[model samples]
Target: MNNNSNLFLCKATRNTYEHRRSSLLCQVCGDRNARNCFGSVSCAPCKMFFRRNLDFDLVINKCIYDGNCEMHENSRHACRYCRFKKCLTVGMKKELTRPPRLNQKKRIGKQITPPLIRRLDLLNSNRSKLSFDQWSILSNVTHVYDQISPLPKILNSLSQSSFPPKKRLRIDGATLADMLGLIYRSIYSFLERIPDFTMMSIHDRNLLIERNLHNVGSTSGLLILRDGDLYSNYAFCRANLNTYGSDNFEGVSKLLNRLDMDRVAVKLFVVVLAFSTCFDVVRPSNMTNNIQLSKSTNRLHFNTINMFHIQNKYIDMLFIYMVYRYGYIEASLRFAALLFTALQLCVHTMEAANIQEHGDMLDTIIADTTRKLNVEDDPVV
Candidate 1:
């Protein structure tokens, strides 16, 4: 608290080594803290500790069961796996360093965990979502009408302090061309609706909107739009393409068509975005432990279950965003998308009742909206 005090109050070790050598890091972990706290990189464990427990939990449980909790870097022994999990939740890459393979050649490389593998697959999974399960069961559900529109009882349930603790998730995706088609339509509709003047020029808007469209197609998910870098391309697209032909109409149309082929990328962006909305992905620490921190379940097991529920309500939440982030997504599109998916599964179980054509609350929305909008303005409305 005083100027006399040093920056790092060392309890175990100091930041400098005895030699004349110095690293661009603190002796303890590398990098300066009281400085670039966020940008500073340390070994895996320390990074995790800083990320997860920065605020400091009032009630931290120690892992006295066995000082087995590795203190290699950021291992905060004062808890269950919560500290480590917090790190990843905060964006610390666990497998960042890739520990060396068995140097002795005496044994095979360490087997990777399913969760870790799942994480990798999610990050780099490029499989085709060429087919979708029967749509009839999943249709009636809509993000606005079914799950997200109203403040659902479930969300309120979680917020209730009087309620018993939060329950862990138990339950828990693709079709590419159709996926791209839907997202493209949404983007197209979004662009078409933009007022003329708000744009630097229609050409400028077109390129930005076009690139936005292309990014979605290329990534096949709505999250594609979130990347600031990709969206900027639209600005340049209009500037360059406009100059290339300066109002050449056919050139513009050709560009649209060129981007259209990236429907896979766009659709993938939506799919992934939909998945996030469908699930919390990152389970809260208390919630995770309460639910059973099955070390066996790979990282994605958490993400999978989170997104699945989100899908249950909207089934179309992410798709809605891909189509049009203007309204539904800003409003918890993913939450509904996942819930709708669940509603479909519920239909399967109630098959004897023939629940396929029977629409849920979402039908009410369509009916209500349809009544107000006349035929001429109907589509726009």
Candidate 2:
């Protein structure tokens, strides 16, 4: 066979394998066909098994086979402990499982509560409006952001340094590269903590990172500047100043100063940016250099639909939380401002990347961080 034929066959084989791995076989047992259950692709048996054994920790730990039992449709029943462990390992969420529905016949007249009583119940329920799952997502995203953010470390280092508070810290190409590297790594770490992101195929995850990390990093940079108060101390050195010019720095400062500075809102926006398909207001003349646009070859392999779904969740959460915290009119204005700021940041980031050194630095940072993430975890099947 010619090279083209071989390549075609290889691609076909890989796609088939991926489809089977993701949609056909049970994620836990790898034997029966699967369906979406409790936030994972699992067979009915595994779904029932997990629902029955809500205390998964207690059940899985009492393993007779030392937690290493090989599970399949036939052998899954042989070891309940390992089977349940596999279910959890494959991203099955207990919280996603619904409680058994009450018999409608038994509760037919229960809905006829007094109007006053119903009003009181509604008023009380409205006191804490967010659902458990929404709260969980909000808490998880913010906690992950806090854990991976470099601001605290940067602040500590600044406090311990002997440099004068008013004196500017010179940021050369190398220093700038290092700062971006830390930001990229933190963004990568933050994304890894998200279940939906982690559940994607390795190809999809890497593609998202390659195309969107820098744009996301721009938003992240604002958080760092706002949180660390780095605007006063950090300044680009003469070489970088000439390369990026003063206007870019001023733009960043202006955006930072104008931002409303809601930590939760910013964190959720970062998540939204990470999954964004394109950041450009206009198509770039050189698509190859634009981190905002996915390459054609990569676009063919990318799970755009899945990414949109994931992005929508965070976007919804962001808006809902903003409305809950700030009133509707204020939330609407803040959201518009946040998006405008993001666009300005993207323009600045693209301009910076047009410089050879800045572009290379971003590429290196992304490659290094991608390698680390791939090494640390196997892609979810």
By TM-score, the best candidate is 2
* After superposition, candidate 2 runs with Cα above 4 Å error: 1-128, 156-171, 234-243, 280-301, 373-381
TM-score of each: 0.20, 0.58
Mark the 10 consecutive residues where model 1 has the least summed lDDT.
Answer: 167-176
* Model 1, span 1-381: residue lDDT tens: 653354455521364542212333432233333222344334444554554444443254322223233222232332234444444444545344333553434343443322344454442322222125313222322221122211123222212334222211110011112222343334433323322213233333322332233332223222322211112222222433332234432333333333322232233233333333222222222234535455423322323343355434333433433334233222245445433433332222233112222222222322332332224233553
Please state the error at residue 153 of candidate 2 in Å. Answer: 3.6
Error of 2 at 248 (Å): 0.6
lDDT of 2 by residue, 203-279 (tens): 77767777788788878878886665455332433433656788887787788877767988998898888888775
